[model samples]
Target chain A: MYLEIKDLTVLYDRAMVLNGVSLTVGKGEFVSLVGPNGAGKTTLLRAIAGLVKWEKDTLKGTRAGRITLEGSVKFDGEEVTNLPAHEIVRRGLILCPERGRPFREMTVLDNLRAGAFGCKDKKVVKENLERVYHLFPRLKERENQISGTLSGGERFMLTIGRAMMSQPKLFMIDEPSVGLAPKVKEDLFARVKEIYEQGSTILMTEQDVSFAFDLAGRNYVISKGHLVGEGTAEDLLADESLRKTYLGL
Target chain B: MVEAILINGLVLGGMYAILAVGFALVFGVAKILNMAHTAFYMVGAFLILIMTIMLGFPSLPSIVLAIAIMGITGSVIYKLFLDRVKEHPVAVMIISVGVAILFQEVLLIGFGGHFRGIDPFVRGFVEIAGIRATYQQVIAIATSLVALVAIRLLLSKTRVGNAIRAVAEDREIANVMGIDVSRMCVITMGISAVLATVAGAVVAPIFMVHPLMWMHPLTIVLAAVVLGGLGSIKGSILGAFILGFAETAVVFLVPMGAFLRGAVGLSVMVVVLLLRPEGLFGVVFEEERL
Candidate 1:
């Protein structure tokens, strides 16, 4: 496995957001974690990306509730469980957070440029910008427009495009289809598919079960802080309990 | 008389714009209500006095050294104190207030409460539109415009500036993009300190320097920042100029207006706040503030 996890448990004060959950993803594999709202899928991704640890460190002395995280996350055979979020990103693990949180006041192009902040070489950055523009031509057209004014689907594209600018080895996308119209969702699905086909590893969490199943090579079913099942789409669908109870299929 | 009012207003507004921009940047980037900000201005003025008068260093080098020292002091303050308490807003503000008072008292003990003066970098006066203005005033205007334009370029045209803006806008998202948020905050503090110090150094000859001089600027700067909408750089500059002109206009038009200047400026703030609670350029959404 390129990315390995073991016994990852996260506690926000007394609430067990993720309880002794473990998972893995091999290089260049497309894996999806499908679960309903509050099922700990987001928590799992956040823990892996080091954001939960960041929250814990930042909220240490404040009245903000405490977060206790315990686990081992190894990316590319290196321990990343204790690394800061920026360090995790520097090592090529990136998260496109939910709602496509564009830097609302900045231009679309500036947002993309910000995404490429870590890369120092101007040539490489320019190439990445062109590549992103090629992938989503709409971004190129609206490059000067403020990102806050972008529509739901365009924001999602911008988020993904921004993530692409980072040259990630593993992309963790959280709920890309949420709050988007079906047509927009279809367009995003095609973009994600193109990204994966171009040889990128992806671990995605989705509420839309069929959407996840349609694109992901493998799947994990999570419910209330635990991974209930894991298999290929056909294997999980054939399991009557997982499909009906967890997948809501 | 009109030229005198216009020149004085421009000079005062330019100084206020420089001061408020620094204050606004610290607040925007670090979310710190840094009460110690104008204290840096006081320190800068005094530093020039000590170096030029006591140590016998040249005036220009003294000013440059003072600005540099304040920049480092600002960075160290953020790293040593502000960074730890940043998650707690009230704690940050209280600590900053404590810092400001500490600077004032230390200066009072070392130099006494009597007002002091420093020689201007450029001596003599220039006639601008039939009004005689000191060369120091011209320098202040030029420096303010130059500093603001440079800062604008830095924020808009450079990679580090983009990262700074990114951190200011959304810290978590910036962290996820591999931009070090703490480092950005520290750098912003340093920049803010430099700006305040420059404002102090340039205007030291025009205004008498004293340990208590920091208090008046703090009151007016807070008003300007609030009136222009907090955390918006352009708004702060705009707000500063408005108050500067308003106070200058009062001084020209009303009897005892010099004494009534601060009250008039703050009244503008109050009226503006009553009409638009967010100020002229303030964003309604907390997340959108910069």
Candidate 2:
């Protein structure tokens, strides 16, 4: 397994957000986690990417909500459940958070440059930036424009492009196609497909079933914080009861 | 007489702006009201005094050493004190006020609560608009201007500066993007301390240094920053100039304006806030701004 999770659980001050979820993504595999709202899908991805751990450390004694994370996350044969977010990014596991959260007041170019912060090789950074520009021409078009001013589709494109600059081995993206126009979503998915085809492992959580089925080779049906079903897209679609009960298909 | 006043007003405004810029920056990037900044300024002046008078150091080196000391003190304070109460504004304010008083008390104990002055970096001045401003005033104005321009360039052109701005916009998002946000906070605190110290070093000859002097100047600079809208360097400069010009006009134009110094500053702040609630160039404080 390229990425492995064993008994991962998260609790936010007595409210259980995740419950001992175990899953795996093989090297160079495209896996989609599909679930409805309140399914703990975002929390799982965040936990895997070390955000939950960061929150647990930062909000320990504050009036802010407490987060309790328990899990063993092994990425590339190394224990990574307790690493900080930036250290995880340094290790080539990147998370593109939901809803296109860029540094809003910054210019698009600056945001993209910030993504390459961990990379020291200037030549590699330049090449990655050029590739990001090529992947999302819209981001290149609005390179100098402030991120807050970008449209919905443009903002998503910028964020995804920003993540690409980090050169991730396992790209965990949460709801990339949400709130985008159908045509723009199609364009974005094509870019994602291009990335997958180029050999980086991808784990994405999406609400859109058909979109996930079309792109992901294997799928996990998670609902209310537990992995209810796991199989290939064809197997899940073939089972009528499983589709109706869990996937809402 | 008007020319002389105007010249003095601009210089005074420039010095005020320099003093407040770091305060604005710390708030802008960190969202912590560093009320202890004025204490750092006073300490800087005293450092210069001890160096030049007691240790027999040159005037320029004393100022430089003071700035360096304050810069280190800033990072240490952030790590030790401000870091604990960063998320709570009221708590931060209280702690900062406590720190300021502590600094004042320590300085008083050591120096015996007497006002003292440092030798001016320069001794003479050239004619400006046919007004005979002393080198002390000219040096204050020139140092502030040079520092401002250099800082502006540093922020706009450097990678580290860009990282600082990104963190200022949204600290969490900046961290997620692989920028070290805690390191940026330390750097910002250090820079703000240096600014306060440098301002003290340059302006100390004219204003003199006393343990309690920090309280009044802090109040004035806070007013200037608030009027300039918090967290904006340009706003700080504009607001300081506006305050300086208003104070100058009062002293020369009104019959008993010298006595109305405190009232004049208060009214100037009130007028600016009444005219534009966001200050001259500052953004509105949105809930999501943090």
Best by DockQ: 1
Q: Per-residue alpha-carbon lDDT of model 2 for A167-206, expressed as tens digits?
A: 9999999999888899998988988999899888999999
Top of the candidates by lDDT: 1
TM-score of each candidate?
A: 0.97, 0.94
List per-model TM-scores for chain B.
0.96, 0.93
Model 2: DockQ vs. true structure: 0.62
- Identify the runs in model 2 with alpha carbons over 4 angstroms from their true place: B270-276, B284-290
What C-alpha lDDT, on a 0 to 100 scale, does residue B266 get in candidate 1? 74
Clashing pairs in model 1?
none
Output the lDDT of residue A249, model 1. Answer: 82
The stretch of ten residues in a row with the least summed lDDT in candidate 2 chain B is B281-290
Instruction: Say which docking band candidate 2 falls in.
Output: medium
- TM-score (chain B) for candidate 1 is 0.96
> Candidate 1, residues A1-249: lDDT per residue as tens digits?
999999999988888989899899999999999998999988898899888988888889765548889989999999999999999999999999988798989999999999999999999999999999999999999999999999989999999999989889999999999898999899999999999999999999999999999999999998889999999999999999889998888
**Model 2 agreement with the true structure over B112-201: per-residue lDDT tens digits:** 878787777778777866777888887888888898998888776677787888888877667667777778888999998998888888
| CAPRI-style class, candidate 1 | high
What does candidate 1's lDDT look like per residue over B19-136, in tens digits?
Answer: 9999999898888899999999999889888998899998888889999999999999889989988988899989999999999999999999998887777889998667888888
